[model samples]
Target: MVNKLEVAWTLATVALIAGVAAYSTVLLYHLDALPAHPDEYVDVIGHQWFWEFCYPQNVSKVGCFNATYDPTTGATTGGHLWAAPGSVVQVNITAADVIHSFNIPGLGIRLDAIPGRVNSIAFTVPQVAAGTSFLIQCTEFCGTYHGTMRADLVVT
Candidate 1:
């Protein structure tokens, strides 16, 4: 005859694993779900040493801008990732050159930027004061200048 204690322990372990699996399944589904309507959409293109942001819905001319980082002054010129406070912003990310990882550590946002394939992620901007900025960095080892590849997410 088998031991009763062993059987009980085995059953308990199986039940615990099943519960964890179910919860993980549901969490993964929700994590990948995109918002039905986002307040703003920005196309993020990763390059060798800079980031390019494009707003397709701009009423004026095409809103494509490049962000160049200056290490000395700790400033970024040309453009930035702009969104309104408390608004839902979606970014379509891709790489124009090699693979890159777009990461905003403060917001816990990270996504791969692969060439020819667009990946999208949506996030709600924090209800902070206007002009507040979050640092955007490339986590992937893209090239020689990858360390300096940075941008800013500025609240409009």
Candidate 2:
């Protein structure tokens, strides 16, 4: 009976240790995955299959500009995403319709856009030329034109 009890205790202890290790690994991974303090906060609103970007000036200021990108010339006329190379840009995303995903393959980042909820992802702009462009697509299937939902990320 004593031998059987010792075996059971040993098994229980090992299981507990494994569980703690697994939990710590997950905690550390998330801590590293999240972003640091952001230099700018851009609000991205996802519609049925479209993406609308809004850039706010400051915390107290209500004035902001809407983003409109030019794919042909890789130029932004009105107000688009403009950031320096190697700058941290934190984007807060929301959805007006179904679920959509903001995936930037160049930056290796993807975040979900949920209705009535804002999800944020912070990433550093890579060192590239002023006219360099990247594609932003929706990874999630929202509606008919899920494949056509795309935009250009022009780094300045």
Misplaced by over 4 Å in model 1 are none
lDDT of each: 0.94, 0.75
Task: Please write out the lDDT profile of model 1 over residues 60-129, one tens digit for every residue.
Answer: 4277899999999989888899888999999999999899999999899999999999999999999999
Best by TM-score: 1
> Which 10-residue span in candidate 1 carries the lowest summed lDDT?
57-66
Error of 1 at 39 (Å): 0.6
Pairs with backbone N, CA or C atoms under 3 Å apart (clashes), candidate 1:
none
For candidate 2, write residues 1-156 as lDDT tens digits: 379989999999999999999999999888556466777677888776557777675554244444444456654444345566777888888888899998888889788999999988788898898867777778999888777667666677
Candidate 2 is scored at a TM of 0.70
Clashes of 1: 0
User: CA shift at 109, candidate 1, in angstroms?
Assistant: 0.7
